[model samples]
Target: MAFGQGNGLQRQVISTLDNQGRDVMGLDTLAWKYPDSSIVSGSLLTVESNHFCVLKSRGAVLDVYETGQHQIITPDKPILGNIVQGFFGGNSPWQYEAIYVQRSKLLAQNKGIATSKEMAIMEYTVDYYVHVDTKDDAVKLITHMPFAGERIPMAELTAYAGPVIEQAINQIVQVTPMEQINERIHDIIELAKGHLSEFLDIYGVHLNDVKVLIMPQDARMRELISLRAFGMSELEAVRMYLALKMADMGLVSAPNAAAGTPFQIGSSTLGTFDVGATAGLPK
Candidate 1:
């Protein structure tokens, strides 16, 4: 029962198939013929038979010795990290450093014998945080936080936040036909409001779970809500609003909004707000 950590409690059988569809099962025989490829350390090499060989690495297996028809098998390794390269420093991380050292020691103990793939997976938890030059760099580098990981630093947080901010800005400014831009601005505001409401619903600590009567009409309060909703600075929201307004007035369209302007819906604030403002128009 060969088992690897993170893969949970399950047994796996590594067997090779010969041309006649016979199972060739012997670790010693496999190791003798198909010496592990040195290009990648900790790769699994198994002899399917005298004529065929299989190599397994990461969670994937490949039959390279079969020239005309090669069989590639992708195994399900439960403990494998989702964002392997990006999470760990591309391919290597310090957390895995200890594993490598331990593996070396084991090999030395066994007089430089090849270790199993399952052993490699357990020896090191693919370090997703390796490429981070500094604590700040780490925050920026992390795309999705693991189930229970530590918080990233402020500088990295800023780096991560910058692109999303830019994207939001671009969405606001690049509206064709000034009228359409104004409508988008209103949409953005509404979206911000909606997000805030959702946030409050999720974690608002009311008096013993009693609902807090927070008014949505208050300007500063609304701004705060918007900031939290979009996770952007107040200044960014303001800039987005202004850009949308500029688009509404038939001013120069932002570069991203070069496409034809969309139809505008009449605002409630506009005089005699009517649903029929542009109704019955062809799509």
Candidate 2:
């Protein structure tokens, strides 16, 4: 499964083996489309979970878990677009306005810009606008428009966009079925509990407060705890756990709790132990 936002919309493509084991591809055409978009290229495969992996050249790979549900296996990193220089030859104000609106919306959706300050930069800068399409047969035209002296770096643009994207995601997650939401919540809590335990042991924070800080009425937290209780691997539990936590904390949001990178514990390793011992018998 590869998901992306481009040309002011979102797109999802699913690839699977056909009945005879040949590759089959499916897509949602209503999603965004970018002409000349660079293909994800690479070869190394990284396993994200039982249901997902990262393919070298492709983006994330999802494991089919239940009907209409998939475990996402991808990083939370933003994809950068190649910059090209070009001019739109036209004299029509309406066409220019359309192009500007489309470009601005695409940038906002993809880059995740949210702050008033950031938006101002985008709105006041010629560098951000680049060109305006005028007529159907204007051919090509170039002019030495004065540099507007204002620009947002690509990195800054991505940072600005991240939280906005997250907020949009949370809105969607809020409407997901309670059963699935709870499962993911439990998974996250369990991972956080483990991390809290370790952090307490190492830095000497009290266990009582750790529990309180990580426990609440959040459905995603509950699911993480359940995953831990069920003997899921620590890494698996943690990844699902973190994704949900980030979602809850308003850091990033995905369609479901299973989307995004696994939790990254600095130095903990999984051990073969009774789930009861590590997770504490389910409450």
Candidate 3:
């Protein structure tokens, strides 16, 4: 707690020291807000290392303070100082919100579904790292991202970035052939990292790293892709795949010849196979 003397009234001192304990405990706390908005002139604003303070009012970011102690009405910070001086007496308190934003890196793992160039549906998971790297970034985060509680947690940051990461993955997969996706996984991750970095720039966040893992959702597609990844030609891979027939228990779905049913083999559809009527197979 900090205090100041102005106009025979006590001005409040504010800092994130009260909440720093939670931050140090790996809570992933992103930003903490001072509970009261009635800020007084000449009050001390303490900004700790690896964090910055965003001064805002009426939903607008008025000023940003870096790692240092700032007198609320200092001459160097005209935007906030002027705003405070305009309405209240030189030494009176005014309404302003102070948001302290942390600079710690955040890691998030997100999964999404997308279709490849061959129209094979794929499911992918991306692990990414990001952080607010500058005062401008801190301002951008506070201005662009929504905050409802006393603080913003890392989970919310991940939630905001999940769709962006998935969108980047979709863009990459939509143009990559299924047969080549496995071989180009490293290239895909690099492209996704670049795309996510560029996408987060507008929000003042810097992406540090990204890892993506993609595989087709269809069982047959997964098998085919896995087989093809072993330097096998498409025909060789398909020929190597065995369609097992079960007698008691196996992966067999023999179509009923009486009903003339059709079944899928690999990527092809085959007509019904006729078995003798006395075969005694389940219909």
Candidate 4:
């Protein structure tokens, strides 16, 4: 909406304006666009510090403004003049888009699940930082990425990058043995970051850092890992496993009465063991 301000001597028409929201530090909004197409000839454009305001029309950049209030003027360049609609005298609307791009790094995190080489379900938490490096990079971002609505939020970028990270993790984890996953955490992170960086580079986003944490979700998997880590005797480990299975099947109950059957433990289907067949024990 265009509005008037100032005294009767001189009036100003602000076709569209940023509300100082983008200037605040630690905000999730990375970029914003002026929504109204009724831009006046001499409208005011406020570009905050650490930001760039770009004027684009028909997928072409007309002019770039940085960190100040710029008065709208039709580009005098021959190529741009052919694309941008002329600004008529007085308060007339012009057909051009004003986009503000913030130059700041952003952090995003996501949780996902993938199967390991041993078929154990593993939960993964990934934290990553990303940013658009320069004004040209920001322009490439706006050009390549799908911009919806008036502003771009941090969640959208995370959502776009989440699948790529997941695919990379799955590829790495699928080949890694379950017992070695803990020791290879650093390698997994580096590998996933490398894969994600290559994919995001085309869109002009830099992956600053990526951290990956993975844990087994299966109780049986945990027990096997403990046995391997602590170097427990084979007989002792077998006895302990048998005792746990007896309790799980309700053959042995805790010291409380009135219990028909104890709740089964570690009901997760991932990496489950059939005690009767695998342990050579009668059902």
Candidate 5:
């Protein structure tokens, strides 16, 4: 091809990537429609920083470019687009799609209610961030993202992530007791990260980090656990709780037991509380 002819096609067929247009940063667009569906060989393809351009022919990823200008070619194109245009009398433009994708790290928040193996219900929240792992992963992400223009909304990424988070919570809660759920949340977070990374990896998405947030359905269950941790038996904890409630109700007076008095079931003081020196009694 003559240099002047190449320049004419370059100038008339493709324009320099303009940052002032739809390709600007911080857009929610996941996939963008390349202006020209019929791409001629040697047309300039520009991809800005933190972005990648994917070329697809007949629904197969043809080429992937990152943060640079690239040219579309016929011989090197994948799928049915690889056919030499020389057969058609001259170099011909091929029908293809060039989609731009964001490569910046993205944050996703998800929530679900998990039912434990013991039938305990727990509400859990998960937050994580991800970015394209490689050229292969970027194409995989586009399967769900499609193109709004030039940016893929983080919401769509996270929306698909919700189910993954929910499944992780279910796996963790199934074996954990309600009373221990709070304490196990950290471990559950790690486990959730494992599940998410494994699942997203299929689409070439890599997990950067994960955080698990949980609120036990029963706060009272947690309180009872704390009381038991203090060396109080379950039955003792119950009685102590009852005594405190009754005292607050003014239904019983504070303990003033005699010296050396054995603890009585009817006493107003808890069995664990110190009764102190017997009042009005001989030493």
Candidate 6:
């Protein structure tokens, strides 16, 4: 909290967030409002080591306090040892907005992503750790990151970054089948990491680490894999795939479909298949 004297009134120039006398936690950014748009000439500003404060007025960043405490006083000669000057104008008061941006690594997670339309309802999860990649990006992140209570939900952050993640995954899945994608999950994740790193460059965040934690969803792909595991030939696999896909497309009616006649088992005007050969064969 910063104490300032403005218009003969002493006010605490602190953030509404975490102002209830509780230890702050899980928040990425917090801000302070000047008392009635007034700032004392010489106020006590307490800044933490891992927190950076930005003072802006008229949409212009005036001074930045990276670390330590300052009296919030502009030096007389613009030379106050190592401190940056130009924050204070005169002995009266200064009006500006102060925002604090967190400088710690944050983890975000999202589960059950279907990369593209071609992908079935497969559940693949992504895990990543992110931090402010640059000072400008830090400012950018602080501006848009949701500020509710004292903390922005890590899940929300994950969702915010989901589009970039899914875009990267979709690029990889566009060329590869689910079989190969599932087999080389780690490699695909590495590709996604690279893509996400580039995609989030505008947001000023670094994808420290990203991975596909679990990849057990493609039902049809899994079925194909199971058939292969059971020593089925490639020709049989293709035939089975066609049959299943046809039924799935509704061209071949399901078991509950009405039959034309009593002896007509799966008798359709479209065509009749020799189910005898495709039935239980030599194992």
| lDDT for each residue of candidate 4 in 111-134, tens digit (9 for 90 to 100) | 889899989899899988887777
Candidate lDDT values, in order = 0.28, 0.28, 0.68, 0.65, 0.63, 0.54
In candidate 1, stretches whose alpha carbon ends up further than 4 angstroms from where it belongs are 1-151, 176-184, 189-283
RMSD each, Å:
24.7, 26.3, 8.7, 8.7, 10.1, 9.7
Q: For residues 81-100, what per-residue lDDT tens digits would candidate 6 score against the true structure?
A: 23323433323234455666
Clashing pairs in 5: 29-151, 29-152, 30-151, 30-152, 31-147, 32-149, 117-174
Q: Deviation in angstroms for 208 in model 4?
A: 0.3
* Cα deviation of 102, candidate 2, in Å: 14
TM-score of each: 0.16, 0.17, 0.64, 0.67, 0.60, 0.57
TM-score of 4: 0.67
N/CA/C clash count, model 6:
0
Candidate 1: tens digits of C-alpha lDDT, residues 1-283: 2211111112222223344554333221112111112122222323222323324354233323332233222332332344444565334321110000000000000001111222211010100111112222222222232211222222332243334333432343344332233335445434333433333222110111111111232354444445445765555554444444446766553211222233344542222212222222212
Q: Candidate 3 at residue 106, lDDT?
A: 72
Per-residue lDDT over 1-283 for candidate 3, one digit per residue giving the tens place of the 0 to 100 score = 3222222223556676543343331447777787767675667887777788998876777789998888886332443445546655544343578888888787767787888898988888888777889888998877777775877777777787777777777776889887677777887788778877877787787888777888889887787667677876765555334322222334345323323344556986654433432222333
Candidate 1 local lDDT, residue 80 = 38
Q: List the residue pairs that clash in candidate 6.
A: none
The lDDT leader among the candidates is 3
Give the candidates in order of TM-score, highest first: 4, 3, 5, 6, 2, 1
Off by over 4 Å in 6: 1-21, 25-38, 74-95, 115-119, 143-156, 214-283
What is the lDDT, from 0 to 100, of the residue 165 in candidate 5?
80
TM-score result, candidate 2: 0.17
Report how far residue 36 has shifted in candidate 5, in Å: 4.3
